[model samples]
Target: MIARLGDTEQTLDLPPGYTLVALRELGDAFAHAREIAAEAGAGTLVWVRRYDLVEFAVVLEPDEPLASARRAFFAGMNALADAIAAHCPPEREVAFDWPDAIRFDAGLLGGGRLAWPNDCAEDEVPSWLVFGVILRAAAMAHVPEVQAASGVSLLSEGFEMVETDAIIESFSRHLMTAFDRWKERGFEAIARDYLERLPQRKAGERRGIDVNGDLLVRLAAGNAAPERNSLVDALARASWYDPQARGPKFE
Candidate 1:
């Protein structure tokens, strides 16, 4: 069942026993979904009502533990980036800033987040996982002068015709494609797709994903030391997301 909070029309595509809820712009999809994820089960998509930002979260029931399943966030982020790039103006650059931030022409747009049951251990099944995402469709209204230089919007960046529904639809399809690639071609294929979206560094620098999902960068100076940041720990603290403002921080 689809529930509407305010003008927001959030729909849940439940596969029989699941329930869906929609919230207004004031609603926190990630926190709300995570709060009731256990009972909501799978197939729950909670979305917020915001024209300037495409905000939503999905619920998943994975068979793996939290640590391994967290990598799944990368799959979602990759697909989310792909969805944005599809409609991006040709030659417009889009790259990821480390683990969880997406940038367009070096400007902050939006990013994704993850959540699970509080008591669930890294080795235990958390019951359900919530993969949340947001996109800056348009610039916010009347921002402070100092903050103006930091934030950006798709409209300002030449993505004029994009819409919230279109992004969400494309994201769902791309996410499924990500999963298929992960299953058929293997995680390496998924990693390659994600890595390709990242902006290239200096000439001759190479990048690869380690087994644990840390970004391994190989510089041209004959340096092979891998930048081994744990994916699980990194995701725990989203660098781009600002909880107080309910959006990304442009620094």
Candidate 2:
């Protein structure tokens, strides 16, 4: 049962269980969601209304400890990629840059971020988790033409007539599907989906996600141990985001 907070002209057709909290164009969906995540509980979605960006955040309550629960970030990334693939133009491709950055045809697109309570310990169950996403829907007039070309947007990538709302709506459904897969299959299933979107750096390199969300990489022919890439460090800052620009980086 998706419910709207107060009557508003803008609405989202989210999945049956989501609760909607719409924000103004200048609102920060991610920040607001984190502030109210405890009382909001799971399935609370906060969306920002903007013409040039697709921004939203969803609240979740994980059953497992914080260490393993961070794997849910992969689930969110998979759903974000899947949602873009659903509306992508033919011949265009969507891929990820390791832990967080998203790319379109090798150009930088926006990415997802995860947040939990400051006091939550690795072995303790977090009271709540928030997964937030921001994608460049259209090129902003304020951005310099040269800089704008360095990054990709839905409109720039030939996604004709794709409304920002459409992407968020699709994401809601895909996220539910992803969580369902986690319930029925396992976290490995979600990890597989995420790895599939990541571009391989070497021909014989194999990649896997660790129990605590670190990326494990190994050469197929080597007897050496797998190299571990820390998820915690990578997620500390979103590679694609430019804080000064307040959006995805242009390079």
Candidate 3:
């Protein structure tokens, strides 16, 4: 993969240990990364150069079992929202819908997806995990009032100066920072940062990722300890992805 900027396409400057693979405007960065992650190894960043969406994927080799490794997805999502917030114009609300959807000011702005080897078992350590990201940088058509009311693009949401390269670079940097914190502190650090950005939780309901990545929702009071949300189940299908169009679903 090769990255194309504007008129003259070039590789975006990535941090050390990161290999940049740039794809054409129409290439699917996520699919390609998923296909090649086993061989690509860690620190590989696959990016697609397109006008409308900033699409990319990263390869990671986790030191833990597949079950616990999936918790990294939460950290990745947190870093993504942080990267966007870093460049966001002041006071524009950014949040997550749950396990994996990102919204800005109550409008959809695309989200993330995770993939691993199909044969990998929960107890086994997979060869690699591919975390893919897509962000709507521009609206492809004339967004109707109703549709626009529920979704928005970066340009539509006051991000005129923001570009795909900048976001990707920022995400890589932030992801590194997030991982470092997780290593130094623990998953609690990642969970705290992520839960803080979650849209609206019922008051007194605290949420956190379990040892195996399942969502643990605990009430502040009552003997009602509710059932857990299986993170594996939630990530089995991308909630915000549109299978028919092979892109994000909005409205």
Candidate 4:
């Protein structure tokens, strides 16, 4: 069913059990979702209607501790990538840059973000967690030529007439599937799926997600110590996002 909020009309076909909260173009889905996360409960999806970008955040109530629950971020990323891949052209490749950046081929296509209460400790089960994603749906005409050229959008990447609503709907379905897989198989399955999409930085290198969601990388050659990339540290700042532009980084 469609929902109308303010002046925007929602055309999302989300799976059963999702509650829609549509926002106008100027609204911030991430922040809004966080504001209502506790009261809104899980399955609440906040979506911002914008022509040039696909922005949305979903509220989740996890049964696990905050440390491991953060791994839900990877599930969200996998869902986003799966949604994009369903419409992506044959030659285009979708990949993740460590914790939070989504890349289309070699260009940035935006990414995901995770949020929880500031008071929540690693061992504590947070009241709520929000997983948000933003992708450049189309290139803005007024953006500087240099910046436009450096960033990638669905339109620029040869996606034909793909609507913003369609992407969000697709994401909703994929997200449900991701969580289902996690419940049945475990977070390790989700980690494996996410790692498969990540581009290999070097030959003979292996990557895995730790119990606390940190990234573990080691060379296949020997017993050398695996380099640990803390998920908490990596998420502190999104690598693909530009704070000033409030979107994907162009460079």
Candidate 5:
């Protein structure tokens, strides 16, 4: 019923078919999850207990080749955003900034990140992949005023007061649902849902996720060759994370 990693004390009431691995408040859930992903296998959820942030990562074993399996990140993002939206107060908007950062009502609200084996070839089926999430659940004092101006926490954005555990539980269910939809329908449905959540571009431009998960941006409606934004480059480092703070950046 309960699993602990070192000094981590929190307990999470996860949904069926999940394994909760709690980390210390000071632990890095994303990094640690990746370290043990190979042995932990799929459905292992690594979580960190922080008052102002809800951080967690889940290990996944995809049967598809690494090239296409990378698209699982899109499903993770869609599920994460949907989980948060489910708990948010009425009319609160949930959106993404490109491939990784999530925004709420246009305010930076943390986002998702993913990791896979560094040396795996594109065509090889990866042994494991990790999808991590970090969300600002409460206002913090150390967040810079200017950064805070550009970003927001659920508490500051007028969201209903909700428990971090509840969010994680909801996310687990949503993630399973996302994978189900991908299986029952196709990756096209997953791609459409994830792309729809991005900050919509200008009228003439269009956007999409390629088979390999690169973001394709078209500057004009017709006769325009879309520009490719490499997902590998984009995810090399998390855009929404602050290395100094070791958590989600306010901006």
Candidate 6:
């Protein structure tokens, strides 16, 4: 992994077992990575050169079945959080909203996404998995006055000192740390890290993540039962992201 990725095309000489695929800002790293993942195999990082957002995707080859392996999303999310927090001013708040929205001081920063072979079955080994992430380093569009109160960017949040390449490099290293921790400590550890980053819930409210990565929230009412949000279904409908628009939305 590089501590700094130079602008030159040849600046990305990665370590063995890793393949580097660079794309112009116009390219979609996530879609491209997924398209090439089966042939590229693990450790393939598809990175796009963009200043407004640090967008990239990595190829993963999981040994576990798709159902159990979906937990990898937590690892990526945790690493993404760590990467952002590293540059955040002390005490500046950052948190997650359920499955995939990330917020900073209660304002949106960006989120993560997961993709696997469409034909993958719960019991079958996914041919490949791609973990994609985007972080707002600079605001590309003006938030409407009404929505401005709920939106944020790294620059506005006192993270203007952070550069896009630095975030991606930090993410790659932290992602490796997260994966190692998950491999040794199990998905429980990964889930705990992810949940800890979520916004504080109401008092007496309990939250837990399901085996398949759904969010389970329980209110402390009599006969209270956990309500489950289908992570797979929600993620499939639409990403919280808009590639063409170049940002996220409340939708």
List the candidates ranked by TM-score, beginning with the highest.
4, 2, 3, 5, 6, 1
CA error at residue 194 for candidate 2, angstroms: 0.7
Per-model CA lDDT versus the true structure: 0.76, 0.89, 0.83, 0.89, 0.85, 0.79
Please provide TM-scores, in order, for all candidate models, with all chains considered together.
Answer: 0.85, 0.95, 0.92, 0.96, 0.92, 0.87
The digit string of per-residue lDDT tens for model 3 on 5-26 reads: 5576666767887999888777
- Give a tens-digit lDDT track for model 4, residues 31-103: 9999999999999999988888889999999999999999999999999999988888887789999989999
Show the lowest summed lDDT stretch of 10 residues, model 4: 1-10
Identify the candidate with maximal TM-score: 4
Candidate 3 residue pairs that clash: 1-21, 1-22, 2-22, 3-22
**Candidate 2 lDDT trough over 10 residues, lowest sum:** 1-10
Kindly report which residue pairs in candidate 4 clash with one another: none
The digit string of per-residue lDDT tens for model 6 on 117-176 reads 989899998988999987777656455655544557687677764455667677778888
Q: How far is candidate 1 from the true structure (C-alpha RMSD, Å)?
A: 3.1
| Alpha-carbon RMSD to native, per candidate | 3.1, 1.8, 2.5, 1.4, 2.2, 3.4
Question: In candidate 6, which residue pairs clash?
Answer: none
lDDT of predicted model 5: 0.85
Looking at model 2, residue 248 earns an lDDT score of: 80
Residue 30 lDDT in model 3? 86
Give one digit per residue, the lDDT tens place, for model 1 in 1-251.
Answer: 56766565565343343355678767888888888788888867787767667788888887787767777778998888887888888987778877788898888888888887778897886688899987777665545656755677787777764445567667777887788789898888988878887776677778887755677787868755855667767777988887767777757
How much is the lDDT of residue 60 in candidate 6? 92
Tens-place lDDT per residue, model 2, 91-162, is 778899989988989988899999999999999999999999999988866899887877788888877654
